[model samples]
Target: MDTLQFLIDGFAVALAPQNLMFALFGAFIGTLIGALPGLGPANGVAILIPLAFTLGLPADTAMILLTAVYAGAMYGGRISSILLNIPGDEPAMMTCLDGYPMAQKGKAAEALALSAVASFMGGLIGTIGLILLAPVLAKFALTFGPAEYFALFMLAFATLGGITGKNPMKTVVAATLGIMISTVGIDNTGVQRYTFGILKLYEGVDFILAIVGLFAISELLLFIEERAGAGRKLIQVGKLLLRPRDILHVLPTTLRGGSLGFIAGVLPGAGASLGSFISYTLEKQYLGKKGHFGEGDPRGVAAPEAGNNGASSGALVPMLTLGVPGSGTTAVLLAMLISLNITPGPLMFTQNADIVWGVIAALLIGNLLLLVLNIPLVGFFVKLLSVPPMFLLPMVTMIAFVGIYSISHSTFDLYFMIGFGVAGYLLRKLEMPLVPIILGLLLGPEMEKNLGHALVISDGDWSVLWGTPLAASLWLVAGLGLILPYIVGPILRRRMRAAITEDAVSD
Candidate 1:
C-alpha cells in the first residue's frame, strides 16, 4: 500500500514537463556516447556528470538526466556492434559476434532494430523487477551490519573476475590499491594518516580526481591511440528498414535473457557482461540448428542486447535498495545520492518514497523515449561514425573542460583534467578494470561510515558483524565470489572443446 502511494508521487515528479524534457535529452546524448567505440556507459557518465552539475539542477533532476544518459548510451552501443563489426563496449562484443555477420548478409537495419526492441524488452522486465523487488529489497537492507557491509564490499571487489579481462590477479591488485588509496585522508580517530604533509594531502587523496584521471582522461588517451592507425570507412549503409517479423523473431531470446540478466544484475558482484555471455551461450544451446544462435542469428543478437540492458536496469536495484551499486554507473548515481545528502537503503523507502518512485518512473520513460528516437533516427546516428574521431574527441574534451571549469571557475581544472587523463591511460595499460576503482572512490567513504556506526552500536563487539541473517547470507556470497570463478573456468573450457568439435563436424 505504501509502495503504491510512493510510485504515484514518483510519477508526478518524473512526468513534470521540465524533467521529462531533460530525461529525453539525456537519453539521446547517451545513445550517441554508446554509439562511439570504447567510450562506454561509465565513461559517458563520468564526462557528463560535470555538465549536469554545471546546470545546477536539483539532485533528483540531475540524477534523472544522468541516469537517462547512462541508459541511452547502453542503447546506442548495439548500433555500431551490429552494423560496423565494432563493439561499443565489452558487453556489446557479444552482439557483434552475430550482429556484424548479419550486416554482412545485408540484414543490418533489421539487426539493429531487433537489438533496439530487445533492449526495450529487457528494460521493461527490469523495471518490473525494480518496481516489485526494490521496495522489498529496501526492507531487507535495514539488516546490514558492519560485517555485512565489509562482505558486500568484498563481493563488489571480487566482480573483477566476472567482468574483467584475463587477469584476475591484476584485478585483485588494482582493487586493493584502490582500497589502500581510501586510507589516505585520515583514520577513524580524526588524525590524518597518509597525508604526506603536502597541505593538499591533509584532506586525503581526492578520489574524484583519481576517477577523472583513470576513466575520463584515460579514455581520451586511448582515443588518440586508436586514431593513429585508423582508415576510411569499409561499409556503406543503403537503407533503414526492419520488418515486424524481425522483432517477433527475437522476442523469446529477449525474454529469457532479460530474466537471467535481471537476476545477475541484482547480485552484488555479477554484472551485464557475465549475463550477456551466459545468455548468448544458453540461447545457442537451446536454439540448436534452427535458431542461428551465433552466425548472425537475430535471436543471438536479441539475447545479448536484452541481457545487457536487463542487467543495466537490474544493476540499479541494489544501489537504490541496499545502497550497494551493482555496476560503475550505479556507483556514480549512489555517489550523487550521497552528495545530495539523501541516505539510501531500506529506510529510504519509508523516508523518501517520492524520490525513489520518481527515479523508477523516469527510468521507464527514458527507455521508451530511447526506442522512439532510435528507430527513426538510425541514419542520423550512424552518420556520427562519419565524423572523424579527431573532431569528435576534441569537441567532447572541450565540453568537458568548460563544464568542469564552470563548476569552480578554476583554470587549474584543465591541468587536473590532463593529469587524470594520463593516469586513466596508465591504468588501462595495466589491465585494471576502471569501474572498480571508480566504485572504490565513490563508495569508500560511505562504507567506512557504515562500518563506524555498526561498530559503535556493537560497543566494539566483533560478532556484531553477523547480527542478521541477511548479513550472514551476504558474507557467504562474498566467500563464493572468490571461489566461483575458478570453478566456472574449467567448465567453460570443457564446453568450448565440445563446441569446437561440433564446428569441425559441421564444416
Candidate 2:
C-alpha cells in the first residue's frame, strides 16, 4: 500500500471516539505535568502507563495514549521554561535560558506563542520524516550487529556531554554513578550483583521512581528554599498572536532547528535535550549578533522549541525501527510494548501496521490539538505561576508518591524514591547535571549486553568492535564528539561572551 493510503486508514483508527478521548486525556494530563516545575514527558509517560493498562486498554490504544502524552509533554515543557526561570525538563533547559529573558522583558505572550508555533512546525517536519524515512531506516538497521550498535551508543554518549552542567568532569562522574546503579540487577548470565538479600532488589531500582525523585522531588525542595521574599515580575499578556514580521524572522531558524532535531533524534541516545542544546548553541553563534539572542529574541524561543519537538518525534524512529530507544521516555514505551507482547523492530511495521500507522496519525492530530489548546488557553497556564509554592509542592509530592505506589504497590519503592530525591537535591547543589545520570542508568545494561555479545562473537578479540567500516565511522564520530567539546567549547564561550558584551554596550 502507498504511504498516503496507509495514513488515511491510520487516521480512521486514531479518530475512533474512544481513542480520541484517550488521546485528549493523555495530552491534557501531559501538559499539566510538563508545565509543572520538575516533571516532564518521561515522568508523565511513566506515571500513566500503569493506569492505562489498569483501565484495560488494548495494547494499541494504550500505546497511542502514551505517545500522545509524550508529544504533549514535549510541547508543554516550554510553558514553565518561558514563564519561569525553571526548566520543565532537561530539553527545556535551553528554552529557559532565552525564554525567561523574554518573559522578563514583558514578552511572555510572544515567547509562548512562538514556542507553540515552532513546536508544531518541528513536530510536523519530524512526522513527515517518520513517514518517509522509517521504512528505509528500519531496513538499514537490520544490518547492524552488536559491535555496530555499541559504536552507535558510544557516539550518543559522547554527544551528550554538550548538554552537561558546566563541569564536564562532574558530568562524567554522575554518569558513572548511574551506570553503577544500573548494575544492581541480576546479569544476563543469571548471577546476582547487588540485590543485598532484598527480594525486590533482584529487579533493580525502577527508573520512574528515580526520575520523579530526581526532577520532581528535588524541585520541590528547591522551591521551598527559594520561596522567600523574592518574587517574579508577572506581566499581563497583551497579545496572543504572532506578528507576520516576527514569523518571517523566525521561519528559517525554526526550519533549521527542526531539521537538526530530527537528525539527532534518529541517532540512538542523542535525544531531544541534546537536540535543543545543539540548536541553542548554534543559534547563539549565528544569530546572536543580529537577533540579540538570550535577551528575549523571538528566534531564541523558536529554536529550542522546534528542536525539542522535532527530536521527540525523531526518537521514535529508533524505537519503532531498531527496538532501541533513543531516550528515557522511549525506553519506558519500549517496556510497555514488551509487556503488551508486541515487540518493536523492523518486523513491527509489517506485522503491526495498524499500531504503527495509528501512532503516526495520532501524533499528527495531537500536535494540532496541542497547538489549539496551548494558544487560547495560555493565560490559564500562566495563572499557574500564582499558585503558592507550599501548596503546589505538597500536591506535587503527593502525586509522585501516588504514581510510584500505583506501579508496584510497594513501600520499598517509595523509600527508594525518597532516597533518590535526596541524592538528586545534593547533585543539584553540587552543580552536577542529572540527565547523564538518567541516561547512564537507562543505557548501561543494554550497552553491557551488546558488549558481551560482540566479545562472544569475536572470541574475545577487542578489535571486533572497530572492524567494520560502519563501526569504524561511528567510533571516529564518538571520539570527535568527546574531544572536540573541550577544544571548541572554550573558544565558543569566549566569542559568545564577547558578542553579548558588545551588544550590551551597544544597547
Candidate 3:
C-alpha cells in the first residue's frame, strides 16, 4: 500500500545517522519530563522549543526529534501515575484511577507492564490512523472557507466551558480576552488596531510569548505556592513483572480503547482526558457487571492508557492535515511548524513528505523504545517521580524566555513573554482552559485572510458564508460545538459529582 511505501521512504530519511541521534536525545528528555508531575507533553515541547531552534537543524530532523519526544512522553506519563498515584498530566489521570489502586495491592509491576503494552498498542493504532487519515482528511480540510473557519474559531472558543470544570463563565471570559489579545495586532486589511500608540505593538503579540507565559511562567508562580509543602513519598520499588495472561487480558481493552480514542481525538477541542473518559465508559459497557472497573481491574488500567495514547496520535492528524490543532500540545507543534516555514495542509502532503512520514516513523520508534524501557527498568522510571516541581518549573520558565529571545534576539519579545506568562498564570489559577486561546490564535489569521478572499471572490457579498453546503455544514457543526457545552455541562457535572460521592462512600 501507499502507507508501506511512505514508511519505507521515511526509514531512509529517519535512519540517517544525524536523525537517529536526534530521536534518541528527544526520547531521553521527553521521558524525564513525562515522568514529572504537571509537566505533560505540551509543557515539555514548549520548554524545549529553544533547543529545537538554536541548533538550526533541518526541519525534518527537528520534527523527528520533537515527535519522538512527544511519543515517548505519552508512554512516560504512565510511570508516575501508576507508581506515585500522581498523574503527570490530564491524559494520565485515568491511569491513576486504576493504576494507583493496583500499586497499593503490591502489583505495581503488573500494572506497569499492562500500561506499557497498552501504550504500545494505542501508539501503533494512532500511528496507523495518522497515516491513513491525514491525506483524506486534508482533502476534506481543503473545503473550509473563511466563514467556516470563523465558525470553527467560535466553536473552539466555546470548548472552554466543556473542559474547564472549575468555572465555565470565567473560562469563556478568559477565552474572549485571548481573542481580544489576538485582535490587537492588525485587522484583516493589515492595518493595526489595538497598538495603543506604542511603536513596539505594531507587529502585534507573539503567540510564542503568550504560550510561554500561560504554560511556563504561570506554572512557576503556582509551584511557588506549594514549594515547602510538596507532598512526595519516595518508593523503593521492585522489578516489573509481566505474563502472557496479562497481555492477553489487556488486548481486547487496548483495541477498544485505541479505536474510541482515535475517533474522539478527531473532534475539535476534545482531547486525551475526554478520550480516556469515553474509553472507560465503553469498556464498562462491554464489561457489563462482570468487570470490577474502579476497584483495580487490570482492564481498567488498559482502557485509559490506550485511549489517551491513541488520542495523542489522533490529535496530530488535524494539525498536519488542516493546520488546526485539536489540543494544546498540537497547538504548540502547529506554531513550531509554521515558524519553520512549513504550511500544514493538502500541499504539505505533496511538498513535505519527508517531514510528515519521518515524524510518523519516529513515533513508531519512540513507542518501541517506551515499551522496552518502561517494563524492565521500572525502578529507573519510578525515580523520575522524585523530581521536585520547584526546581523543574524555574528551568522550564527560563527555557521559555530564553527560547523566545534566541529566536530573533528581541528584548520586546522577552517582555511580552513574561507579561503573557503573568496573564496566563492568572487564567490558570482561574481554571480557564488555555487551549481555546491557542486554538483561536492559530486559526484566527487564517479565518480573516480566507474571509477576505471569499468576499473578493463573491464581489464583496456577505452571502458567501452560507452559499455552499460544505461551508454551511461546518457552520452548523461549529454552532453546535459552541452550544453543546453550555447545555450539557451543568447536568453532566451534577451527575458526575453524585457518582464520585457514591464511589467514595462505597470505598
Best by lDDT: 2
Better of 2 and 3 by lDDT: 2
Give the Å error, residue 235, model 3. 4.2
Greater TM-score among 2 and 3 belongs to 3
Total clashes in model 2, counting residue pairs 3 or more apart in sequence or in different chains: 0
Local accuracy of candidate 2 as per-residue lDDT tens digits, 399-471: 6777677767889888998899899899999888776777677668778999999999999999999999999
Report, for all candidates in order, the number of backbone clashes.
7, 0, 1
TM-score of 3: 0.92
Off by over 4 Å in 2: 1-9, 37-59, 80-111, 163-166, 227-233, 239-253, 264-300, 323-355, 488-507
lDDT of 3 by residue, 462-491 (tens): 888778887677677777877776776566
lDDT of 1 at 106: 83
What's the TM-score of every candidate structure?
0.91, 0.82, 0.92
Q: What is the C-alpha lDDT of each candidate?
A: 0.77, 0.79, 0.76
After superposition on all CA atoms, what RMSD does each candidate show versus the true structure?
Answer: 2.8, 4.0, 2.5
Ranking the candidates on lDDT from highest down gives 2, 1, 3
Model 1, span 269-330: residue lDDT tens: 66777667777788888888777645667888899888988899899998888777887778
